[model samples]
Target: LIITIFYSTDNPLNKSAITVPQRAVSTFDQQDLSINMHILKWKVTLEMIKDKPLFGSGIGTFKINYLDYQADFLQKNPGYIKYSGKAAEAHNEYLQMLAELGIPGFLVFLSIIFVFYSLALKYLKNKHNNQNRLIVFGLLMGITCFLIHCLFTFPFHVPVLGSTFFIFLGLSVVYIGGFGLSKVDTKKNIRIKLNLNYLIKKIIIILMFIVGIFLIYTLVFKPYFAEIHYFKGIKYYEKGNYNDALKDFKHAVWLAPYNGRILHALGSTYYHLDIQDEAQETLQRTKYYFNDRNIFRNLGLSYKQSGNYQEAEKEFKQAIYLDPNFTKAYIDLAYLYATQEDYDKAIIEWNKILEIEPNFSEKYNVLYFIGLTYQKKQMPDKALEYFLEALQLTPEGSPIIEEIEKEIYNIYKDRLNK
Candidate 1:
């Protein structure tokens, strides 16, 4: 301590060192100063555990279902919204296993690990096993390396890495048991009896094999074909080629009529094409088949376009309930409120976007919209505050900067006249 103090500065920190400016980096961007996203993901995983503590959401369903749980958490803890996204991994393998497999599976997994280490420790410490100790130690180290990697990453998800780890563990077990990892009594295992029942068993096995092949073709290969069209439709959709996207999606739907994902994309295309009736019709079909938040969001958009504000509001709320961390849904819902001339409600909704701005990408948009809403409510001072905030976030040489400056100038001019 004396040595450290001798080398370090004796000066105290000032306000400039203590406080960061909001102008350059908004509070939204600053929310994720470190690994907060991972922290948020683990919190969501805990919630998933509570919802289904026994069987879990299911093996490998973490990627498919974690978003809904995160959205629910964010709805109550709005401040954590900035740290939300579709994270594919929980960033902690132990937590992920507990979440996706439930308590029973988690305990079983832990037991396997515990037993392995217990046997390993016993084998390593045995003085009689000294000759093979070096090999066992090497293999154990390889497995341990992967185990350490699993603390911050899902190494098991990577086939090569996971296989390597298991190979190391198997080798360690083999080396630890110099006599062999397993033994079978040849005298007890070699007896075989042939009878009429043997022929019957062969025939049944052949039939079962054929049935399994048929099922694989129907469930796996059939969907494989639909996935081709589905991916083609996605590419077209991204290029803003709605007509091409619609054609491909229609073919995909024809191939896999019950595929909710494909159906949802089709519905969204119809909405973008201004066919509100077909959009609503198709989206409603998706509702029965899929539980995606995007489906509900598109349904709300279609309803709003059709002048059904009540239904639109309900659909948007449903979407938010499904995934509050989806920033677009809140923005759309706020715009819906703004269209109804409900300035206060619109501002409130827009402000929520500020609370959960992903990378502060929507900071300028939220501030500018709230400013306009305040202006509409005859609150010029509040409007100016938001406009100036938006201006501070604006990048140099952007056309929007001038627009914000114009709004600010107008507010000042009107105030001077008053």
Candidate 2:
């Protein structure tokens, strides 16, 4: 039975590589596209609007306008045509909405962000209670991270993310707005009812009761349901039954929509299922519940798999922007540029990684790629330098190390013999 269980579990791992062939293909094919393409799209969209900041383009017109603008842009910058195929969306939902939905959508979006931040800040600032302050801080950071990430990717544009965010916003508004005000009113009532010492004692007793109830609810009641659904989702996810996993995850989310971890798991499962759109949407929903960089990285990768390179790069950059020490984004961005044969950009990204992480010894692969790029650029000396650097970084006895050493020797010998 143990053997059977192990085999059954391993089946998903074995078949995972083949489950989404099209997505894999798209990831490989579009991995190396330039980030400039996304920037160009943004620039063209802005230019077409004649610098108007208030009124946006119109609903559903961002994609159309992006394409129209790209055509004009390509005429001026012919190099873009070789890399880009379709006239994609503005890669930025805010900018896209600003262009398409005009001023109304922008204001609505900004207003929502403002409300979330305001309530979170209010709770954090005035709340003397430690527990309430922690919750408020979590919500504040979550919303802030989401908004900052949105500057790059359009996850909020998706219904799942928008709905989830609004739900959290509503919950926050209620929790902070109601509870804080109620506490003040309760204090006033207590003062009116008794002497100062008695009122203080009464408040302490009430707070203690509430804390006890919360502890009981969290420790005894909440775990039973949350654990059951969480495990059920994990089982489905492990078995490669993504539909079942998604249902279970959705149930978990429904039970506790404020749980960021659950939302991230659901979003990741959706991504593995090749439901890129759904994955993007679900992951976006997680912003209200938690602040996890993994979600941003996965969301970016999902967009990349969906042939949305512009959006993918944006998310990757957002991840980096959020935590400059996030090494994965640097590697992914490097891989992205390398795949597109934009070796210069790849080298730039890799160099940035080295700058941020000087001791990142695993960057031999990046060094090798830098060598390859120099070779492509027909700069033999530069290529040789990087090849030597790669050789130095490689493990002493590894086959890859030996191979790199051999290549460096050959390159040097050939150059000297010339």
Candidate 3:
């Protein structure tokens, strides 16, 4: 399995043979493509670690925190083209733990692996009976394989597999005298005594309980509740309850102040509420955590809505600079130009959108807009051609179908009159 995994054309095995220019066009297989994404993920993790070195980004936050640190170059990379969704987990368990739980957590995880191997080896060497020895060897090999696989995949994320793995892990621990403690020897008259330093033990226990509670609340519970509130805000927003959405968004933001999504949502809710200044200020907070094109696009929209055309233009252009194929940015820019009566520039922007997005989902809408732009330019012939093309692209029952057909008929009528 290891040989097959690494020797494939897409994996890093061929990385050394490719020239600098060749690297650009080099195709990575699905597995290797994932590894390429992991490189980006690793960079994000490193940046996240810088901010929260002790506790890292907190539990269950790698996905939530990933986009903020995405490098602009990754947007242009072919390897990342189809890897559209958020990277929820680092494929590598060690790196995932390092990013989410911080250095101390990472070290503790390594210690667990160490203990597993140590006990496995001890059992393998000491077991005399052939059956028991073979069983021990198999368990050792199974664990070794599992750990090796965990290096490149998040097997533990799968519920059934993860449960089974832990079951085996528990069995291993039980077989090895439980929780790193040696088995008590009853035959030897050995008096095992606890070092009873009562006051000191009580203080230590209290301190541990306090620390555990704090860690659980800060890392686990708070983030979970924040996500819940963020989702609630989305639900409210979808129902057109802007005030409730605003309240939930604010609560989410308060809970997860460093969360980019929550902040972005809060800012968007503020914009929906027509509180432009607050929208801008709230969105600005996300800049500290996220360098995403979507966030920039939203920022541009906020500025555009506030009538700050220059800043809006700048933000939209920045979004394009970050992601050359960002169709939404192009559309927004085109509309912005159109609003300013720069029909020529608007048409040019609309054409650029076609150049980048041939298979755009809303192709008919885009064509219809191009037709409208041409009509505004007094080019009836060009307008008619695009309107006809849009008619073909439009779904049969779509409301826009009648509008497009009507425009086509009107253009032809005018031409006949001329």
For this target, which candidate reaches the highest lDDT against the unseen true structure? 1
**Model 2: how far is 120 from its true place, Å?**
33
Residue-level lDDT tens digits of model 3 in 169-205: 8787676663224766668867777697899889989
lDDT of 1 by residue, 1-418 (tens): 5543433433353323322333234424535444678778889988988899888987777876777788789888987865667776898888899888999998997887787787777767766555576766666666777788787678888889878777777666666665444445666877666655878989989999999999998888878888999999999999999999999999989878988889999999999999999999999998766667888899999999999999999999888876666788899999999999988788888877777664567588689889999999999999999999899888788788888998999999998898
Candidate with the greatest TM-score versus the true structure: 1
Pitting candidate 1 against candidate 3, the one with the higher TM-score is 1
Count of backbone collisions in candidate 1:
0
Residue-level lDDT tens digits of model 2 in 84-203: 334445667667777775677678878877866776776677846898888777777776777666766777667899788778777877788766744455546644454468788999
Ten-residue stretch with the least lDDT total in model 2: 16-25
Ranking of all candidate structures by their TM-score, best first:
1, 3, 2
The pairs that clash in candidate 3 are none
lDDT (Cα atoms) of all candidates against the true structure: 0.82, 0.73, 0.80
What TM-score would each prediction reach against the true structure?
A: 0.70, 0.44, 0.68
Residue 261 miss distance in model 1 (angstroms)? 4.3
- What is the alpha-carbon lDDT for the whole of candidate 1? 0.82
lDDT, residue 35, model 2: 57
